[model samples]
Target: MRSSNYDKFPFVPVAAQADACQVGWAAIAGVLQAALAAQPAASGQPVVLAVECYPGTGLRQLRQALTQALQPARCLVAGDLYRPTADIDAMVAGPLTDDPVFGRLNGLTISDFFDAEKLRAAQAELAAAAGELVLVLGTGATLVCPDATVVVYADLARWEIQLRQRRGEIANLGSDNMAEKASLKYKRAFFVDWRAADRLKKQVLPRADYLLDTNDPTAPKLISGADLRAGLAAAVRRPFRVVPFFDPGVWGGQWMREKFDLPDGPANYAWGFDCVPEENSLLLGFGEARVEIPSINLVFAHPRELLGEAVHGRFGTEFPIRFDFLDTVGGGNLSLQVHPLTEYAFDKFGLAYTQDESYYMLDAEPGASVYLGLKEDVDFPAMVADLQLAQADSTAPFPAAKYVNEFPARKHDHFLIPAGTIHCSGANAMVLEISATPYIFTFKLWDWDRLGLDGRPRPIHLAHGAANIQPGRTTAWVEQQLVNQIQPVASGEGWREERTGLHEREFIETRRHWFTGLVPHHTNGGVQVLNLVQGAEAIVESPSGDFEPYVVHYAETFIVPAGVGAYTIRPHGPALGTECATMKAYVRT
Candidate 1:
C-alpha cells in the first residue's frame, strides 16, 4: 500500500492507539456513565438519554454496551417504538415519476418514516420516570427527543454501512431484507432515504452534545462537546482536506491503483472522491480516540468560514466546487449522460444548483476520446428510438458515435460540459472531473448496452435526457466552446499562467500554470481547488507567512481556503526554466 499522508493534512486526524476502526467502548461507556451520574433525577423526574444514529449502526451490540455501562437504567429499543413498517411501505409505494432530465422519487422525511408523536410521548413518559431512561434510535430521534436530558449522535463512515449492507447485516428502511433492484422505482426510494439521511446528518450533528464514531461497533470513539467545537473551528479557519472515498464500478479503471497508492482489490478503483465532502468522511482524533463523521457536517457547521461570506450568501451551506477522478484506463467507457438544468435539478432533486462539469484529462492513451454534445443535423427522435431499442436488449450495441460528438482527448486537455449536454469519458483515459458540488444528478441516456457490476441492466433516463439535452450544442459549436481554449495570461522567471475557462456556464473558472519557482496565487475571498497535474510534487505556502506550507504530490488535489487570500506554489526538484503544470478552480466572482 502507498504511504498514507492523511496525517500530514490539517483536517485529517492521526490514527488512535486503539483498534483500527477507532472504537473505544470503555471510554464511551465512562462518558455516558458520567453524564448520567451528573444529571441526577431531580424532583422525582427521570434523566432521559437518546443515542441517535443511522441505520446499520450495530444497534444490537450498542444496546448491550449501553445497558452494561448505564446500570439501573431502563433501556428502550427505539425499533420497537417505531411506526409500523406498513407506513414506510405506504409512503414509498407510489410509482416512480420522471422529469425532463431524470427520474424522480421522494424519500420519506423523519415524519414519513417514524411516528413523531409517539416518539415524543415516549420520551416525555421516560423523562417523567423516577429512574434513568435510555432511548437508542436513529438520527430522527434527536429532533423528537426534546425532553431528553442528553442527546448523542452516532455516525459511521458510508463505506462501512455499504459493507454491512452487502453482508446482509442491514436492510431497507423498515425491513430486514435488502431492497436490491435495478429498476428505477426501487432505486428512487433508495435515493430518497439516502438523501434524507444526509440532510438529517447535516442539520443534527453540530447540535449534538456528544459525537460517537461507530465505525467499529465494539469500540465506538466519543468526542466531547468542547473538543468537537474546537476541531470544527480550527478546520474553518484554514484550508481543510478530508479523507477521500474510493469505490469500484463496472467500468472501473486501473490508474487509481498506482496513482493514488490504493491497495490491490478484487476490482479496480473506479472513482475517488478526493474533495467531495458530500460522500466523504472526516476524521477527528482527540488524544487517543479518533472519531469520523460525514465531511458535509463541517460545511453545515461553518458555512461562512469554509465557503466564504459571498459564497455562503449565494449558495448557502452548499460547497460550490468538487474534484474527483474518473479513471477509464484499462477499462470501458462511462455512460453517455447529461445533468439537469439549475431549475430542473432544484425542482426534481432538491439540489440548489445543477451539475456543470468539466473533464480535465490527467492522462490518456493514444486514440482515446470523449463523447461530447451531439452531431450536427442529428435526427433526435430517431436517435431516441435507437437508444430505447438498445436499452431493451443487452446484446444491442449503442451507436454512440452516430449521435453524440466525439473529441480526441490528450493529457491536460480540458473539456467543458454544462448541464443538458450529453457527454461521457472514453476508455484508456484518466479524467479529473471538476464540477459543482451536486455530483449525483447525472441523467444517463445510454451505457453501451452493458449491465452494471450487479449483473443487472443499468437504468437509463432516455426520455428525461432527451427532453433536457441541448441540441444546439453541435459538434462545431463545441469545437470552439468546449474544447481546449488555452490562453496565456501571465508569466514570470520560469513560470507562466494560462486561463482555461472550461466551465461554459461560468459557475466556476479554471486556470493552468507552468511554474518552477514561487508563483503567486490568491483565493480572493473564495475557496480554490488545486491539482498537481504534471510534476511529481509541489508546496503551497502563504506569502503573508500566516500558516504552515502544504506539500502536495502529483495528481493530488488540495484546497486553498478563502481566509488565506494570497499564497505561492513552488515545484519540487524542477530544473530552472522547466515548467511544472498545476490546475486551479474557484467560484467565478
Candidate 2:
C-alpha cells in the first residue's frame, strides 16, 4: 500500500475544539447530501454502506468518524466494514444492485466487481446515487466521491493483508506519529547515509528479504476457492489507510484531489499513483544489491523500500529498467499507455521509456471487455483527425472506437501491447501488467463518453497521445504453439531457452508452463516468477509449506527460487489446471 504521512484533513484535535472540526464538517456534509440526492437514487434508504470493525484502528476510526460526521448533517446510510456475505440481490427487487453506493463497494469481494465494464457501469450508476463512504477491511481499494467513499486499509498489526503497493517502501507507521513528518524525498537522502541491521540487515539487500529469508521451501499449492477467499480472514481483523505524506504528485494524491496546508509540498515527490503511472523516485535504484536465499538461488531483486544504503546500491544505471502497475480510481480510461517516441518522455518528463507492456487477465467476469490496438484498414491520419474532432467539440462523439480491436476477455488470456501500442486495461477489469519499467508516457487518444461527478468532462489529450501510437498494429499474437504444451520443472534445476535474446533487458524473458502428476520444479540457480494460470496447486518444500495449499488463483503470481529445490504441485478439487506461462527472467543489465 502507498504510505501516507500527511495530516488528516479538516479534523482538528480536541484542543482546537469545535471550531476546526465543526465548520468544514457541517458544510461539507450538507454539500455531499445535496450532491448525492442530485446524482442517482436506489430503492434502499440512502444506499447501504458497511465496514468491518467500526473503531478497530486509526483507519477504521477515521472512516467511522467520517461517516458519523457526514450522517448527522445528511441522511446517507452506512454500516460496519464487515457485514458477512449477503444474498441481498435475491432478497431485493427492482434491480437489486440499483444502488450506486453498492457499486462503489462491489469489488471489495469476489463478486462481479473485477469485471471492468460492469465495474465502470456500476461506478457510473453509483455516481448518480446519494454518494457513499464505506471501507472493506484488508483490501486496499478505497472509493471517495462527492457523496461518500468506502476505504479498505491494513490493520497496523498485520504485515501483508493489503494488496496495493508503491515501488519501494521503508520506515514504519504505528500508533506513534513519527510518520507525520516523513517524506519520500527524505528517504532518498536517508538511504544515502543508510546502514543495515547488523544481522539480517544483509538479508534486506534485495531478493533476500522477499524470497530467501521468509521461510522453508517445499510447500503445497492446491487451494480451494473457499480457502483462497478466506486465506487471511483471521489474520486481518482490522484494516486502515495511512497517507502520511502530503505530496500531491503521488497517484492517489491527484486522483483524490487532496491539497494540504504544507509548504514546498507539490514540488516534492509522489508515488505516481495514476491508473497507468511511472515511479521515478531518485532513491529507487542507487546501486546494485544481490541476494542468495537459503532455499532459493542467487537473485538481484528490486528494492521497493529504501531501508538504507545497502538497499540503495541495488538501483543503478546497470539495473535502470523497472516495471510496476499503477491502479487509479478515476481518470476515465488510462493515458492510452503506449511507449513514447524515442526518448521523448525522458527528455520531457525525465521518466525512462519502458512502455512495451502486455495484459495478463487477473480478475474478470463474463463479457468483461478490453479495447486494444487498431482494427484493420484504418488510416492513421483519419484516426487522428477523428480524435481531434471529438476533443474539440463538447458534444462530438468519440472517434476512437471505430479504429480499435475490442475483446470480451476471460482470466489468464494474454494480450501483448508492444511499445507505442494504443490500449487500455479498461474500466472494470482487474489486470496483471507485465511491462518494462518507466510507465510515464501515456498518450490518451480518447476516453469513453463519461464525465467526473464534478460536472467536468474529464480531460483528453489526443495531440499528445497520438504522437505515441505505432500505427497498423493490432491486438494480435507474439507467438503461440499450434497446440500448446506444458512441462514440469524442479527447483535447483532450470529449462533453457534456446533463444536467449527473446527477452533482453534489466528484467526480460518469455514464459511457458509445466504441470504433470507429482511434477517436480527444480530452480537450479535463480529466482522465478510463477503465475498460476489454471488449476489450484501447491509448491513442495516452500518456506510457506507448513501452511495449507495456497490454491493458486488463475492469474495471481508468486516468486519462487532455485534454492528451494525440486518442489511438487498437487491439484485439488477439479481436474488439475488449464495451461499457462511463467517467466524465469533474469536481470541482464
Give all TM-scores, in the order shown.
0.90, 0.41
Model 1 / residue 509 / CA error / Å: 1.0
lDDT of 1 by residue, 73-138 (tens): 566656666678777665555523433223443555655666777777766667666765555555
Q: Which stretches of candidate 2 lie over 4 Å from their true place?
A: 1-337, 363-366, 426-430, 453-459, 474-507, 514-527, 540-555, 561-589
Alpha carbon lDDT of residue 50, candidate 1? 74
**lDDT of residue 231 for candidate 1:** 72
Question: lDDT tens digits, residues 206-255, model 2?
Answer: 21101111111121011111221221121111111111222222122132
Candidate 1 deviant stretches above 4 angstroms: 1-23, 93-108, 131-136, 174-191, 194-203, 287-289, 393-396, 573-578
